[model samples]
Every structure is written in C-alpha cells, then in structure tokens.
Target: MIDIDPNGTGLPGIDQLRVIVGAVMTVGLILAVLALIIAAIVWGFGANSSNPHLASRGKSGVLIACGAAIICGAAVTLTNFFWNVGQAI
Candidate 1:
C-alpha cells in the first residue's frame, strides 16, 4: 500500500509564496474596486453629458471591473474545486 500526503509545507519558500499570492489578490481586489469607482464616475458623467458612446463604454468598464473582482475573490476556491475535480478523475 502507498500513501500520499499533500501538506503545503513540503517545500521551502511556500510560506513566502502564500504571502505573495495573498498580497497579489489583495492588490487585485483593490484595483477592481478602484476600477468600479472610476467606471461609475464615468457613467454618471456620460449620462449627464448625454453621450451614449461614453455611457456604453463606462457600463462595459463597470461590468469588467465586477467580473475581475469576482474572479479575484474566487481564485482560491476555484483552484481547489478544479483540483478536487481533477483528483477524482
């Protein structure tokens, strides 16, 4: 019989890697928030100016920012989910 252990501490610098990844995710989320804010401002300005093209661009930007935030927040969960699915195969 063989056994496998998947403890995350098996390698050196893993803790550092975790720290870096955490920092990156934090930065990503912050950027997403900033983007959302900027996009909303653009949208409001465009609406006030009666510019359909600008408003459309701002709306797209808002959607993209929201999507980015969602992906950033779910990165770890998504990775784990895929990992488990792959393991089941």
Candidate 2:
C-alpha cells in the first residue's frame, strides 16, 4: 500500500530541494557565462590581430567559438527554465 503523511508535513523537504535546485541553476548559468567569455577571448585572439604564433591559435579559437556558442545556448535554456520555475510559484 502507498503511504501518505497524515498532516502534510512534507513541505520543508520539498522547499529545501527547490531552494537547492534553484541555487544549482544559478551557479550553472554563471559558469556558463564565464566560459562563453573565455571562449570569446580565445576566439578573438585566434581570429584577429597580426602575430604569427597567435595565428596558430586560430584553430583553437574557432573551436572555442563553437564551444561558446553551445554554452550560450545552454545558458539561455537554463535562464528560461529557471524563469519559468520562478513564475510558477
């Protein structure tokens, strides 16, 4: 048989989990933005400027650009997700 708490005392448990989940999402978005900035810097160093050794870094930058794009997408998604969750309350 399924069990249910007679007095609905489970709120604290549920509330704590939501708080933690929200904190995790906030951290994730922050890290994702930082990674995007780092990737942009790498891509910029690779694609722009006139130095020869810096030229070799272009490929790495292009890869970094791709990574930044992906992280940006993830950040957008996470922001929307958290926004929606917040609105639901």
Candidate 3:
C-alpha cells in the first residue's frame, strides 16, 4: 500500500500556492460572469437588429462563458477526481 499527501512534502510556499490558485480561480469566475453579461447584451442587440451572424456569434460567446464558469468553479473538484482515478490505476 502506498499513500501520497501534498502537505507531506516539506517544500516551502506550498500553502501560498493554494492561495494563488484560489485567487486565480476567483478571478476566472469573475471574468466569466462579466463575459456572460456582455454576451447577453450582444445577443440582445443582434436579435433586435436582426443580424443573424452577429446573433450566432453572441450565442457562442454566451455558451463559452458559461462553460468557463463551470470549469473554473469545478476546477478543484475535477482535479481531485482525476487524481483519485489515476491513483486507482
């Protein structure tokens, strides 16, 4: 049997790494939110102006923003899940 723990590593600044990652994720989520809002506005304007191409682009932006948010929010959980899966293999 083998066990691995991140904290077991006597490396300096490991705790700072966690804080940095958290801050990065927070920034990502904030950016995603801003993107979503801007995309929604673009979508509305396109629809109102009857510009199909613009509308399609706006729709894509909104979807991409949502995907970013999902990924950013679940980043830690997703990493842990994959790590466990890798360990089982």
**Per-residue C-alpha lDDT of model 3 across residues 12-83, encoded as one tens digit per residue:** 888888789899999999999999999999998999999998888899999999999999999989999998
lDDT of 3 at 38: 93
* Reference-based lDDT, residue 16, model 2: 76
Sort by TM-score, best first: what order?
1, 3, 2
Given candidate 1, what's the lDDT at residue 84? Answer: 89
Instruction: Give the Cα-based TM-score of candidate 1 against the true structure.
Output: 0.92
Q: Model 3, stretches more than 4 Å misplaced? A: 1-3
lDDT of each: 0.94, 0.63, 0.92
TM-scores across all candidates?
0.92, 0.46, 0.92
TM-score quality measure for candidate 2: 0.46
Give the clashing pairs for model 2.
Answer: none
Best by lDDT: 1
Superposed by TM-score, candidate 1 places the C-alpha of residue 52 at a distance from the truth, in angstroms, of 0.4
Total clashes in model 3, counting residue pairs 3 or more apart in sequence or in different chains: 0
Give candidate 1 misplaced runs (Cα > 4 Å).
1-5
Error of 1 at 45 (Å): 0.7
